[model samples]
Target: MDLINNLALGLGVAFTAQNLLYAFVGCLLGTVIGVLPGLGPLATIAMLLPVTYSLPPLAALIMLAGIYYGAQYGGSTTAILVNLPGESSSVVTALDGYQMARKGRAGPALAAAGIGSFIAGTVGTLVLAAFAVPLTAVAFKFGPAEYFSLMVLGLIGAVVLSSGSLLKAIAMIVLGLLIGTIGTDVNSGMERYSFGLPDLSDGIGFLVIAMGIFGFGDIIKNLSDKGTKRELFTKKVENLMPTRKDFKLMLPAVLRGTTLGSMLGILPGGGALLSAFAAYSVEKKIRLQPGEVPLGQGNIRGVAGPESANNAGAQTSFIPMLTLGIPANAVMALMVGAMTIHNIQPGPQVMTSNPELFWGLIASMWIGNLMLVVLNLPLVGIWIKLLTVPYRWLFPAIVMFCAIGVYSTNNNTFDIWMLGLFGIIGYGFVKLGCEPAPLLLGLILGPMMEENLRRALLLSRGEWSVIITRPLSAVLLAAALVMLVVVLLPSVKRKREEAFVED
Candidate 1:
């Protein structure tokens, strides 16, 4: 009964004229960015953070949330048509989707992707709504020690699950923690790493770091790369609907992918990219049906499963951020920044203090998903036309937008300079093959971890044993240790490496 009432309230809030309009705009923009290679939801959100300042908090959040999930819908369009994945999560989609396109079944492949995504997205939203309140209730039990231990676990999970070298991921986390400590010490009222700069007194602006690393850095990297030529398998996408056989093959895969993605999306360092890959691996293990295309050879199941998983993963990834104030991924980190800008603290209190925003955001996701299905299917030609725009013209506009967004945050030139500095650092990370996602996690969680650790110590009279004496904190810390141990095992290490390698 309570859940029904809450959803009812959410729908009421979501149905507002302004909220609906922004949701549509967000969905539209998300599709546009997702159709263009090299641009992603992270860079796009970072660039738009400053713009969200003037809008109502719920509307801003609703729109931003739309962009994140809507990208999942648009990414498959390019992957199916041209073998170019618009988003990282769509990388697996290109493997078999392109093959399907080559077989002149591009329409059925795209239709399967769209239909699977819609079902998964709808189911994922329901799952989020069902779980968010219960999780928030559980979160209210956490104390300082538990929160700190949870963050430690989150960081470790990031290290274990992230691609490439474990050493590099750890190093990035440490670097981010160091950078996070640059501002003045809040309790002591003394500068720590300010270097006597007034701007550093309040700490480095989150917008600056976000824009520099993701926004400006991406532009720099995209410019340096020798652009690859993409060939469209079919210029005209006909037969918008899938055959009965295609549906029979697609339904089971979509259901399986949706389940796997929902579970994985809640874990730290797991989101659309990981979920999609895992789903594809699972599909490969299942034997093909009679008369169905084999796996990776234009199989409809291949197109459907990963597409469903990625979209479902994208939607459910919001669970941790909304319920615990913990970012499950880099995009969630940006969302935390968004909430902070509106003076709305994330976590359990949000449901009690701002139920409208919480429920409204949840309801808007369903509406946004419905909008994406309509937008992606019929308007396939427009998205393809967008792909033809040259990088040379698109990049400069992105750079300019990023500059303006960063500068507008504080109206300070120093922020712009910081943006440039971080941009260079971000590019350096790319050159060194280091993943930047962990760094963002570290930066966002570092200060909170420090504060909680200090508070727990102070309350326990500096005994330090309180972290283990408390059952919840002890369990969380133990989990982190176990995760570290399991990940370091030789067999597990090899499997982890295999999981991240793209075919």
Candidate 2:
């Protein structure tokens, strides 16, 4: 009954005219971005962060959230119609999806993806709504020691699950922590790393870092690559409905994928990309029907499973961010930045203090998923048409928008210079085969970690053992230690690397 009332309240806010309009616009933009190859939700959201400054907080968040999940719907379009995947999570989709297209069954493959995504998205949203409050209740029990330990666990989880060298990931986290230290000290009232520059006084703006690293950096990297010709599988898509046999196979796969994705999405470093890969691996292990197609050979189950998992994962990844103030992935880190921009501190208090924002954001997701299904199925032709626009035209426009967005934030030339510097630095990271997600995570969590550590020590009269004495904090730290040990094991390390291999 309480859930019903909360959802009713949420619906009331989500159904408002302004909120609905932003949701629609977000879904539209997300689909277009997803249809276009090489553009992901992270870069798009980073480019648009400044634009949200003018929007009401609820509306801004609703739109950004729409872009994140709606991309899951649009990504499958290109994967099925062409061999290219529009989003990283969609890479697995192109395997069987393109094979199905090649076999003249593109329509069914697309329909499967769309239907699976909608169902999975809806389920994921319900899970989020159900779990967020309970988790928030638990979060309320945390003290400074526990909070600090939790963050330590989060960073360790990031290192364990991140896709590259453990040493590089740790190095990136340290660099981010160092970068985070650059500005005025909250307690000391003195400059730490300003180097006498007024612009450095406030520390690096999250917007500048986000736009430079993701938006501009991606554009520069894309420009460096030689253009490859994209082959469209079908000029005209027909039979948009799936057959009974298709439904029989996809339904079970969708259920399994949704379950797996929902669980994984809640874990640190586990999001849509990882969920999709894990789902694909799970599907491969299940025995096939006698006449059914093989895993990568135009199987409808392949199209449905990973698509469902990715969408589910994307939605549920918001759990930790909204409830615990811990970002489960890089995109969630940006969301933390978004919330701070509105002067809203994320965590357990948000539900009690701002019920409207909490419930409304949750409610809008259901509407957005419905909107995506409506947009994707009937408007398939339009999305395919968008694929023909050349990268030459798109790249310059993205670069321009990124510049304009960054410069408009502070109207300062120094920010632009910093943007350029970071863009080059971001590109360097790409060149060095380093993942930047952990760095962003570290930067966002660094100050909070430091503050919590200081508070814990102060409360304990400077006893370092306070961390190990508290049961909750000790358990968390123990979990982090176990994670570190598990990941370091030779067998586990090899399997971890294998899981992240794209091909």
Candidate 3:
């Protein structure tokens, strides 16, 4: 009864003219960014952070949340149409999605992706509403040791789910952690690795890393491959809706993806990107129907599952931030930054003290998902036409936009320099077949892990055994070890190799 009344309160607030307009605007902008390769939710949100300063806190947050999930929806459009992933989570979508496009089923693929996303988003939001209170209660019980151990488990899961060689994934994670430590030391007033550069004292911007690696890096990869030709599947999209067979095939995958994403999104380092990859891997491992295409060759399940998982993960990743005040990913970190700027502390108290704001935000997501479906389904042909645009023209424009976007954040030219540096590094990662997603996760979690580890030890008066002695912390650490062992197993390795590889 309380849940219903609270949700009713939320719906009332969300339906306000001001909030609806912003939600629509955010969804539109996010979709535009997602249609273009390299400009992901992180970059888009970073670019738009300055805009949120003047708006009401509820409107600002509702808008930002819309953008996050809207980009997830838009990313699949690019992945299926152009064989380019607009967002990292959409990377797996490109595996079979592009193949489906090539086989002249772009309409069904797009419909499946969009429909699956809508279903997943709704279910994810429901789960969030129902489980938030209980999760917050559980969160209050976690001490610093448990937090650090949970992060270890998350990092290990990243390694387990990463597509490339285990050794290389571990290396990327280490490199990310090293980069994360480049700023000032928290305990001491001294800067650790700034090399006398004052700009380094504030630390490398998440925007810089994201725009550089994904935005500039994608430009470098696209330009270097001059012979690439894109085929437009728009003409074949005469039937915008999915076939009955597609509906039958897609429902199960959507349900499974929603479940997987909801569970994983609550983890420390897991988010839409991880969820999509994990969902795709699982779909590939399942038994296929007799007449169905192979997993990597235009299988509708491949498109439906990952797309659903990604959106669900995007929605549920909000749980940690909303309930526990802990960010599960880079975007949620920015949301935390938003909350702080508004003089609102993020925690269980947020629900009590700012119920209107909290519930409104949740309610707006459902409306936003509805807006996305209405916005995207009609725009499918236009999105497919984007592939027709020449790379030579597109790449230069993207590079310019990235330069301007990075510079606009903090008005720092050094950030632009960092962009160039990471571009080369990102390109290198691509060439080496290394997934950059895990590296980003590692970078975000590294500082938090350090802070928690230090605090846990301090509370124990420097007793090292406290990490393993705490019940919850011990379980988390043990889970990390198990993940490591499983990842190293010969059979799991072979299956992973098969899962990530495309035909």
Candidate 4:
């Protein structure tokens, strides 16, 4: 009954004309960005952050959230058509999706992706709505010690789940913590690393860092790759609807992916990309039907499974952000920054104090999923048409928009300079085979972790044992330790690397 009413309230708020229009606009724009190569949700969301400052918080977030999942929906289009992944998570989709296109089954491949996404999005949202309330209850019992331990677990998970050298991931996280410490000390009245500059007093703006790394840095990487030839598959797509047998094959994969994604997404740092990769890997090991294509050779299960998991993960990743005020990934980190800008503090209080905003965002997701499917299936031809625009022509417009957006934050040149500095660092990360997502997560969580640790120590009269003595905190810390140990083991590490195969 409570769930019914909360959903009713959410629907009421989300159905407003203004919210609906922005949701549509956001879905449309997200699909375009997703269909195009060289642009993903991180860069697009960061580029658009400044523009949301003037809008209502609910509307702003609804639109931004649409971009995240809409990109998930749109990403498979390019993967199937041109063998390109519009987003990182879609990389797994290209394996079988493009093969399906090669065999003139492009239409069915795309349909499976769309339908799988729709089902998965619905299931993920339902799980989110069901689980968020209980998680909020559990969060209320957390002391500073427990909160600090939870963040420790989150960081460990970020490092462990990341698809790269664990040493590099750890180093990147440490660097992010160092960068996070640049502001005035909250406990002390003195500035620590500001170099006596007034601009550093407030620390680096989250938007500035985001735009610099994801926006400028991404553009720099794309431009650095000289004269790349993008092969556009001009195969005509016929029969855009999946047959009954096709649906039967995909349904089981979709169900399994949805379940896996919903569970993984609630964990800190486990979201769409990880879920998608894991799902595809799992599908590869499973037994195939008598007449079905093998994995990576136009298997419809490959397209359906990863696509479903990807969408499910995208939706449910909001659990920690809304329920516990912890962002699970880079896009959610940007959401945390956006929430701060809107003066809407994320956490348990959101459910009680801002129920309308909470539920409205939830309801809008259902509507957004419908809009995405409607846009993706029937209009895929139009999206394939987007394949023709050379990335060289797109980068300039993206760069210009990023510049204007960052400047709009303070109407100053300093942030733009900071943007340039981080862009260079971001490109360096790309060159060094380092993944930047963990850094963003560490940077966002570092300050909060420090604050909680200080408060915990202060409450314990400077006793460190309180952290390990508390049951929940102790368990969380132990889990982090166990995860780290597993990742460090040579045999396990080798298998882990094989599981995350890039091709």
Candidate 5:
């Protein structure tokens, strides 16, 4: 009953003329960005962040959130049409999606992804509505210790699930922590890593770093792969619907992916990406008869499974951010920043104090997902045509858009300079075989972790043992330790490497 009422209220807010228009626009733009090579939802959202400032908070977030997951849907288009993944989560999609395209099953693969994404996204949004309030209620009981413990668990989970060398992931996380420390010390009003630079005092801009690393970094990598010709499949897309046999195969995969995604998405870090990969792995493990399509060999299950998981994960990833004030990914972190700019406290109190924002956002997700499906599926022809644009003409436009977006955030040249610096660092990471996701997780959590640690110490009168003494905190620390140990085991180490793409 409460769910229905809240949803009704949310619909009331979300269905307004202005909000509806923005949601549709965001879906379209996000799909466009997703279809383009080398761009992802994070960079698109970061680029569009400045525009949100002019709109109501609910409207702005609705649009931004639309862009975030709408890209997840659009990403499969490229994965099937070309062998490129337009977004990180869709990389796995390309492994089988493009293969399916080569086998002239492109239509079914895309249709599976689109339909699976719709189902997962809708169900995930419903789950979010169901869980948001109770989680927020639970969040009310959290003290600094609990909050810190939760964040610790989140960071650990991120590192554990990340698809890279464990050591490199840890190193990247530590580096992010160091980078996060570059701003002023809030407690002491003292500069820490500012090095006498005014811009440094505010710390590195999250948007700048995100854009540089994921956005520009990807562009450079694609450009550097000079001879890698993107073969666009122009094969006729007959039967743009999954067959009954395809449905039978994909149903279980979708269910498995949705379940995994819903569970993991609540954890901080790269939950969406992790869930996608995990879903694919799960589908692969479900043994099949001889001559059945292998996991990475253009199976329709591959398209449905990961697409469902990714969308479901994307939807639920908001739980920690809204309830606990802990962002699960870069986009959620940016949402937090946006909420702060609007003077909205993001923790448990948000449910009680700002029910409108909470419910409105939840409701808008449903609206946004519906809008995305309606906007994306029939427009496949249009999106494919976009693939025809030569990379030479497209790359410069993308670069220019990125530049304009970065400059608009604060209207400061310093941010542009910082973006370039981070771009170089991002490229270096690619070269050095480092994964940047864990680093981003650390950067997002570092300050909160520091604050909680300091407060815990202060409350305990400098007793460092307090962390171990508190049952919750102790459990979290133990979990992190256990994770480290488990990953170090020879069997687990090999498995972890195989699961994650090479850096």
Candidate 6:
């Protein structure tokens, strides 16, 4: 009943004219960014961070959150139309979605992605509202040992979830951890990998890495595809609405994705991205009846499942950040920064101390997600036309935008250089057939893991056994180990190889 009352209060706050306007604007901008290749939610949110200083904290946070999920919806549009993933979470969508476009079924794919997202986003928000406090209570019981174990599990899950050779995924994670070490050491305040540069002391900017890898790297990959002119799937886009068969196929995928996403989004690391990949894998495992579009040949389930999963995951990710002061992803970390700037501390006390803000943010997710569907569906035609634009024109413009956006962060050109360097690295990863998703998880979790490891050691006076001796930590570590073993088994290895090679 108290939860109901608080949610009502939240609706009141979120429904204000100003908040509502921002919500609309946020969804619109998010869609635009999502459709534009290379500009992810992290880069977009970071670029917009400075501009939000004058706004109310709740409104600002609400807008940023809107952009994050809005990008998810927009990403599938390009993935389906151009075989280019506008967002990393949409990469799985490209497998079957692009095939659908080739067959002139792009309309159904887009519809499935959009509608599935709407359902999942709504259901995920409700789940977050119901479980956030309880989840936080569980989080509160976690000590440093437990936190470290959780991080280990997160990293392992990341590697297993990546779509590539296991060894390659491991290499990517190691590389990410190495990149994560470039900053100064927290305990001794000594620079471990700075290489004598002052900027290195503060660490490689996440904005640079994200922009270079996701933004610039994409540009290079698309350009190298041996096509002088760009190709767009110009299917007259008849019957913008989905058919009955489309609904039948997409419903189960949406439900499964929503379930998977709601559960995984609460974890740390690339929870949303992992949810998308996991959902796609689940969809593939289910044998289909005759007449069903085959998975990876442009099946609507491919688009619907992952799209719903990621959006739901993105929504539920707020649970950990809000309730436990634990940032599950880079964007969530920025949210934490925003909250701190507003003189609000995130954690268990958030519910009691700022019930209005807490509930309002939760309430606003529903509003923002609804606005996304409304904003994106009608705009699909507009986005599809973007694929017709030439790479010669598009790449340069994207590079320029990235430069300006990175420069705006700290008014520093060094970040631009870092972006270029990381872009090369991103391209290298592409050539090596390695997935970058796990790398991102490592980058996000490395510092947190280091912090928790040190705290646990300090609490136990340097006893290494504390991690395994603690009940919660032991269980988490054991589960992670078991998962790793299962994934590495000979039969599982053969099956994974077959899945990747499946025609």
Query: What are the lDDT figures for the candidates, one per model?
Result: 0.91, 0.91, 0.84, 0.90, 0.82, 0.81
TM-score of decoy 3? 0.86
TM-score of each: 0.98, 0.98, 0.86, 0.98, 0.93, 0.84
- Per-residue lDDT over 1-503 for candidate 3, one digit per residue giving the tens place of the 0 to 100 score: 87788889999999999999999998987787788764677756755665677899999999889889999999988888888887778999998899988878888898899999999999999888887778767877889998899778867877776667888888988887888898889888779789999999978987788777866776788677756565555564656688898888989999999999999887766789879988988897898898988888899999999999999999999998898776777678768766876888877778878999999999999999999999887887777676566668867766777788778768989988999999899899989988776677777778888989999999999998999999999998999998889878999888777665644
The superposed Cα distance between candidate 1 and the true structure at residue 166, in angstroms, equals 1.5
lDDT score, candidate 6: 0.81
What's the ranking of the predictions by lDDT, best on top?
Answer: 1, 2, 4, 3, 5, 6
Residue pairs that clash (backbone atoms under 3 angstroms), model 2: none
Candidate 2 lands at a TM-score of: 0.98
How much does each candidate deviate from the true structure in C-alpha RMSD?
1.0, 1.1, 3.3, 1.2, 2.3, 3.6
**Model 5 — which ten-residue stretch has the worst lDDT?**
227-236
Per-residue lDDT of model 5, residues 249-362, tens digit only:
988888888888888888766557888988888888889856669878888888899999999999999988888898887678777777876778778898888788788888
Candidate 6 structure quality by residue, lDDT tens digits, 255-307? 99999998878775545677898899899899987898789887888888989
Candidate 4, residue 83: Cα displacement in angstroms equals: 0.7
Candidate 1, residue 188: the lDDT equals 90
Candidate 4 lDDT by residue in tens digits, 1-503? 88889999999999999999989988988898889878889999999889999999999999999999999999999999889898788999999999999888899999999999999999998888998889999999999999999999988988888888899999988988888999899898789799988888878878788888888888899888886576776656788888898888999999999988888787777889989998998888889888988898999999999999999999999999999998988889889888989998888989999999999999999999999999988887799888787777888898889889988988879888998999999999999999998889989999999999999999999999989999999999999999999888999999888877856
Sorted by TM-score (best first), the order is 1, 2, 4, 5, 3, 6
Q: Which residue pairs in model 6 clash with each other?
A: 96-298, 100-298
